[model samples]
Target chain A: MTIPVSITVNGRRYDREVEPRLLLVHFIRDVLGLTGTKVGCDTSQCGSCTILLDGVSAKACTCLAVQADGASVTTIEGLAGDSELHPLQESFWNKHGLQCGYCTPGMILASHELLRCNADPSAEEIRHGLEGNMCRCTGYQNIVRAVRDAAETMQGGTS
Target chain B: MFAPQFDYYRASSVAEAAALLEQHPDSKVLAGGHSLIPVLKLRLAAPSALIDIGRIDGIRGIREEAGRIVIGALTTHAEIAASATLQSGATALSEAAGMIGDPAVRNRGTIGGNVAHADPASDLPAVLRCLGAEFSIAGSSGTRTVDAADFFEGLMTTAVEEHEILTSISLPSGSGGQGSAYAKFSHPASRYAVIGAAASVAVADGVCSAASVALGGLVPAPVRAEAVEDALVGKALSAGAIADAARCVGDSLDDDEVLGDVYASAEYRSAVAHVWVGRALTAAAARCG
Candidate 1:
């Protein structure tokens, strides 16, 4: 069966006929060609499929595309403007938060959601915030640093 | 993983959802999709239709009415974790919500879906049982309330009827020095509880007037330690007395059958159960003080 779903993604409204079984992650990646949102684990264990739904970070893999109809979603690719990088992205690059970079986009998006609500999250708070995201390559130390750095930058710190 | 094909209906209201469920007998309600999607991907259970109730209005708030806190069915774990009301009134529920499958899961997973799925390893069921929460279910007929103790039947099962949708969970206002705590040993990979305990104690004049203990992850469903509660009543709120009461969990386990998995042995889970009960009791006692 096909269902008409109209969703707003990254300030763009898209209307599409989707299958009931279509996952929100696949819809964002395959239908919209926003491949930045990676699907690491089909299971909800890995946070590689994290995305912002209605301004909150959530696992996109477990959410049905139809469930997101009439809702606002933001993927990793939608974080920055055309020329500028999001603060979290810049922090990841400057802090060497990524080793393989497979988990970078999701990590940045998750961190973006955290910093939106909490501009100055402590190290423990950042760790707790990013607990859902798994980064096998960087060992999480740099990820934590990148989030803290991004929080500082977002708070208008010169450095 | 691709989910199996099924007819999808986005229900705008509780009545619409109930009607859809009634129309399609083999349909499932999609809330957070944390539990159902996995089953669909695994092909373990396939429903003919999915009634997505994620966008339903009036099912997403937390409010206090009279002397009870009413939590809407679609209230996400993230909301609960950040809720000051829950933190102050139902600290155990807030702690358990915080310990759910991390941030992303907490942000998406709804409390309604968790309790409806009735997973043995879920931290909320035990805490709800300990707190004596009540569930409000809506159907074509009308709304009905079910006590937490009577709601859960067995493994991954509940008393929720096929046509019924769980709308909200209600917890009575704490009065007269009531304290509660939930403690769990989680699986490293999935973060599901291997053995969890939720304890609530009503203290008066430095003595325990009433106590309730619910154990999870060790059995098919969350079970109350009635013997322990009975033993702890009127006992002095001391570490030694709490320890003695916690030992009654072993007695409770002897009467009930406990499920064992690769993560823990029956004996090991029983031991962990005692430790968790002790920890919960200690925390609850501290809250009383």
Candidate 2:
């Protein structure tokens, strides 16, 4: 049976009939055609499909589409406004945070929540906060650097 | 990964959820989806219907009620970690909640769901066991409260009946002078506790007036360290007293009864559990003011 779900994705609303078993990641990629959120590990362990569910970071792969009905979702595609890349995306590019770039969207969104909670997090705190997002390519030193740089930029670049 | 085909129903209230469960015998209650959806995708469970209780209004916040801190069933681990009341009154629970999977997992996992899932290796159950928390369960008949001891029955089993929903959990307040801590030896990858211990102590005049000790991840279910609790009460809570109590942690269980895997052997878990229990107790005692 199909369930009717209305979700606001990247600030746009789309009402669709989704299977109850349709994961939010599939709903975003297949239904909405926003492919930036990668599915690294289908299991909950990998943070590759992370998204902001109502401004909070959550694993999209584990969340059913119906569970997000009427909820506001922010995907990697949503991070960039018309012409400007998000500070996190820009930092990832500038700081060499991505090699495969598969984990970039999830990393950026997860880091988005981390910086939101702790604007000026220490390196240890940043590592702890991004424990959910894993990148096999960058070895995380550069990813850590990118998040640190983004924190500085987001904090008005005093550092 | 996609969950197997199932019909979904968003339960607006507890009664509706119970009714849906009655209407669909193989229905699963979806709270946070941190545990349930993963189970669904793995096909470990294929419930025909999902009663989504994530949006249920009455079961969502933490508040003080009648000398106790009553936490709604849907209160997320993130909320628990951030709650000042929990940090001060129930430090063990808050810390355990913080240590679950990671940041995204914490934002979605709920204490009620965790307790209801009753994963043998979950951190919150051990802490809840130590805190002597009570679970409020709602069913078609009515609502009833079950003590933590009676709540977790066995591996992935809970006192919550098929048609019932755990609505909230209640913990005693006035724990300012009491100290509580949770210490765990977690698997490096999954981060699930290999062996975890939680202890709560009320120290009066440097003596342990009241104490509760519980252990998880070493056995089929979270178990109260009755011997440890008995050994600590009325004692000075000194290093020697704690060491003596720690030794008794796994005395109640046989070696074979404890869970063993490549991550840790049953013998190793039994041996290390005492150390964690001791550490948790010491931390709790140090927090007592």
Candidate 3:
């Protein structure tokens, strides 16, 4: 049986009927065509499906669309508000933070939540914050640098 | 991987959830979806229906009532980790909460789901055992409460009946001259404890007056380290004293009962059990006022 689900993605509200088995990641990618959110492990092990649910980073692969029926979702496509590029997005590009780029979307979204809570997170804090999202390539040194740059820029250039 | 077809209901209240369970015989309570979703994806167990109680707002906050700290079942691990009350009053619980899975997992996993699913390696059971927390379960008949020791029956099994839902868990607020801590050797991949230990101590005049200790992750269910507790009751709680008492934790385990697999052997887990127990005791004793 299908049930009615109303969710606000990015800034627009979309209402649809979904199966109880449909995962939130599928709803974001398949139903809404927000394909930027990639599914990595599908078991919630690899944080490739991370999204902000009601302003908190959660593994979309591990949650059902119905579970988030009345909530708001923010995916990678929505990260850069009105700006042409969010600081994290720009730093990732300049620092060459992506090798395969498959893990980049989840990495950026997860890092966004971490930087939101802490504007001046140290290297260790950034590493610990993004532990859920995994990158096969890059070895995380440049990812850490990109997040550090974004944090400095967000805090008005402490660098 | 998609979960199998199942009817869904978003319960408005605890009573409604219980009633839904009664109406739908094979229905399951869906909380944070951290545990259940993974199981469903694996096709381990498929229920006919799912009663989504995630929106029942009344069962989702942490509060202090009288002298006890009451945590609604819907309270998430992130909330518990960030709670000032838990951080100051029940430091061990907060520490364990922070050590659970990575940040995103902590954000969505609820205490009730973790407790009800009752994975032996999960951290909260051991902390609850150390703190002597009580669980409140609601059913069609009414609400009933059980002690932590009795609430957990076995691995992935609990005292919550099929028709019931856990509403909240409560424990005495931290007392004077008391401190508690949880320590674990995390399995590098899964992050589940290889051998977890929780210690709560009361010190007075440079001597240990009372102590409660529980061990998890290595055993089938969380067990109280009574032998360790007995050895510390009258000791000075010095580094050496704590080590000597913590070693007695061996007496509480049967060599044949420890869990082992390709990740960690039973012998290895038994050998390091006291190391974590000692670390927990040392840290807990340091926090004692």
What is the lDDT of every predicted structure here?
0.89, 0.90, 0.93
* TM-score result, candidate 2: 0.98
| B26: Cα error in model 3, Å | 0.7
How do the residues B255-288 of candidate 1 rate in per-residue lDDT, one tens digit apiece?
3478777778887898768789989999988887
Pick out the ten consecutive residues of candidate 1 chain B with the lowest summed lDDT.
B254-263
Over 4 Å off, model 2: none
Clashing pairs in 2: none
lDDT for each residue of candidate 3 in B1-289, tens digit (9 for 90 to 100): 9888999998999999999999999988999999999999999989999999999999999999999999999999999999999988999999999999888999999999999998888999999999999999999999999999999888899999989999999988998899999998898877888888999999998899999999999988899999999999998998898889988988999888899989899898888899999999999998997
- List runs of model 3 lying over 4 Å from the truth: none
lDDT at position B95, candidate 3 = 95
Colliding residue pairs in candidate 3: none
Error of 1 at B240 (Å): 1.7
TM-score of 1: 0.97
**TM score of chain A per candidate:** 0.96, 0.97, 0.96
Q: Write the per-residue lDDT of candidate 2 for residues B1-289, one digit (tens) a residue.
A: 6668888888999999989999999999999988888788888999999999998989999999888999999999999999999989898988889889999999999988888999899999888888989999999999999999899899999999999999999999746569999998989989999998999999888789999999999877788898889988999989999999999987756677799899898888887788999999999999997
Docking class of 1: high
DockQ for every prediction shown: 0.87, 0.85, 0.87
